[model samples]
Target: MDAKVMNQILEIAFEKRVSDVHFEVDNPPFFRGRGQLIRSKLPKLKPEDTEFIAKTILEANKRQLDPSLREQDASYSLPNGGRFRVSIFRQKGVIGIVMRVIPPHIGSFEELNLPVVLSEIVKAPNGLILVTGPTGNGKSTTLASMLRYLNENYSYNIITIEDPIEFLFTSSKSCIIQREVGIDTEGFGAALKAALRMDPDVIMVGEMRDPETIDACIKAAETGHLVFSTLHTQSASSTINRLIGNFPPEVQEVMRQRLADMLVAIVSLRLVKDKSGENIIPVVEVMRSTTTIQACIRDGRLDEIEKHIENGVAQYGMQTLDQHLIQLCQQKIIAVDEAKRITRSMDLERKLMFTS
Candidate 1:
């Protein structure tokens, strides 16, 4: 109910490796780990308790809670420097809060169990790199790792436009500047436009939320700046369609050409419980741009993109979701049923029948 109790709750979450913590008016705080939400044994929260917790978060960020404010996005830090991406919203006329844990240190591809192909994907000198997935699937963390790789290896100027700025990066070989949406800049679109003029060699936009931001990303890539952003799509094909679909019908052709020219890679993520049923690992679908794939996008052959991606596994380090899931099952890292539950392929089970 008080600030110390709230901090204690977050500290406990950090110690337990919880991914998210939820607070609501009539329920005990819930902690999500390994894709399961477990209700705590603590007493259910009251209206004033939730409100006070929300107020404490707002004040920590030097902001006041407005009476008419129905939603808020912010970040909170513990005395030990643990960070959380905080979301506060009104539900049924009462306040509810959810805090997603941001890892204190960025993990490498091996540490996160991400495909080493991601190390290769981020090697592109200049183009758009998109990491797409449904929410809570570790999109942000993957991007952070890529940036970490760049920071340690390259001496480029990097700027990030984030909604609340999740990970705190200290420049290594590269000089880094991070801008938060409301506190540092107006929005993603405006910040992206300004990033282009700041002599940046690499720019990381937190998310492509609208047409203006998406267009800015494409243009930034076209002009030889490495761009990184995230989307909520499930696969490479849908990620392309969603980008081109954001524009008007008359201008979509132009948008497709721009995207085809600027795309470097698309990495889609799905988190499933590993064989031990104790840890979560990413099943990645990687689509690296090639001549054939670019032509498919340029000529509106979206359906054919997946086949090309699957076929490029040997040559270009590309793989479809089904391919990764099958590999996971083959290695006994994940169960076949777990793969089937997350896969979109119709014949995946049949293919697994042969392989498993």
Candidate 2:
């Protein structure tokens, strides 16, 4: 409960320009800087000290960090305007905490260097839009930017279900309602089930972690709510397959139908090292659900969906990861070798590198 300790942690997070801060017993705290991670020079924390810090995070948020206290998590803001989604848990019987720094204000598409399609995604009237990527790939940031765009441009009520709410939104052109997983509702599934009853025009789910959550999200979309969520997948097709695969075999057919009906677009993305080596830029593969894509999902020809993504241009706003990477390379936003290193298509990467 020491203000000085909390201030020091915030200072450390800001000084490193880190998106996250990690603290674990017996190990010195470390922060994830721009593109790399570095250990904090502060002395290693004791168990009691770690607990105190984690508890402080909980107290600051005024949310039950965790029900059982075996592991704890909370979202809180520093006095200086930075926010954090902090997770505290026991690993190897020692307390460990990770504080993901949330910027004071949301970054615009231009500032984040995201694609123009993102602006279009925010303006969608109905259906679901998914942002797909790995951890630390700025998926949350991308989602937040879209939500902020909607806020600034439209008058819609937005409800969010997040485990530890990341970016904070103040009403712009819309009224926003954010619900934390444990604090606001029992869980994502329960919160999503309740969200529909609230009559929201837009629903933002933090992550689709389970079938129940996905089911509720789909239902929300079906009933005409614009749904936005994230998934940990490598490609737009993978994101679709993962969604259908989340359901049981017996019900997958039904779920696929529901998904096809409500699906709008999937933006599978990753952060590749920039040419300047000072930052990372986002590369995305977009898949807009068309009639053929829907038929592919229904007929179990998910593989063919990739070809549609590779070729579809005027029909829908879509592109393949390899192509997106190539554009980034041509634009001098990212290096060819770096794109090749992170690219999933080895053959395509080779061709890209040679041509460029």
Candidate 3:
């Protein structure tokens, strides 16, 4: 709870390249490194320790982490030039905190090892571009890289509505305005609607959490503003279904049509260690909105989308998850068994076998 102790814990986490630090009662602090939970070599923390750390972070950020209410999400900046996104909540009626380490430097697309096609996608004049995956899979980092690329390459007014603003971007060739949900404006929907009136050329919604935010993002894209957002889905088809599922059954069909019109691309990613198990690389599934893909969405033929992604890889710059895994395996970036574990398609399994 003390600043000195917190700094020490953070130093250890940073030095070990841990993604997250967790504190809970009756448990020693844990570090999530390379997607594995590693217990800290320290004594178990008491309830009071977690409570103190939670309150300390909240107070320093000038926010409240009231367990009686809902959980709190906030950002914290360390004195030694580190930033963290902190989630404080009640678990088993005790205080608990999870701090995700946000990298200070936003990496370029090449540095993040994203595909070259992403550079072309990010330069779209207007429409919705989604970078999706489950939690802790570098979705935010990927989105940040795209935005950073735009910031460096183009001259546009970019406005971002983030729950807790993660990567801080100074003005480059583009004019950037970042609004934190609680601190900058009322909420995501409000900030997004207001951003539209602000004449923004590019809008970044941190996460399309609810129907309201999703609707707002779609409308923003429809209005000719290049929009970027994230979803917690595994594949492009599932991402479309998840978006339409947010609306009522009666409106889902209409929403699907609207999404089909405005959708630009969907990139789903997963981070897996390389063959040596030393470095993590992203295996991506990309689905660009081509005429065939749009028809599938409009006709509600979601199941047919994957085949299109596979066949249209060369034509549309789209690739399925299995395709990416196969490439990684062929390149020896990942082992054959690792690719098999990550992929689900028998078709792709046979392809991997034959290719290997």
Q: Specify the poorest-scoring 10-residue window by lDDT in model 3.
A: 61-70
Per-residue alpha-carbon lDDT of candidate 3 for residues 1-356, written as tens digits (9 for 90 to 100): 57789878987787777899999899899999877899877889888898889888888777766758458888888888788888888888888899999988899988999988999998899999999998989999999999999999999999999989889999999999999988889999999989999999999999999999999999999999999999999999999999999999999989989999999999999999898887889999999999999999999999999999999888778899998998887888998777776676757668977867
What are the per-residue Cα lDDT tens digits for candidate 2 across 188-235? 988888888898999999999988888888988889999999999988
Compare the candidates by lDDT and give the number of the best one: 1
Best by TM-score: 1
Off by over 4 Å in 3: 346-348
lDDT of 3: 0.90
Minimum summed lDDT over a 10-residue window in model 1 is located at 347-356
Report the error of model 2 at residue 232, Å: 1.3
- Which TM-score value belongs to model 1? 0.98
Winner by TM-score between candidate 2 and candidate 1: 1
What is the Å distance of residue 239 in model 1 from its true position? 0.5
Q: TM-score rank, highest first?
A: 1, 3, 2
Backbone clashes in model 1, listed as residue pairs: none
RMSD of 3: 1.3
List clashing residue pairs in candidate 3.
Answer: none
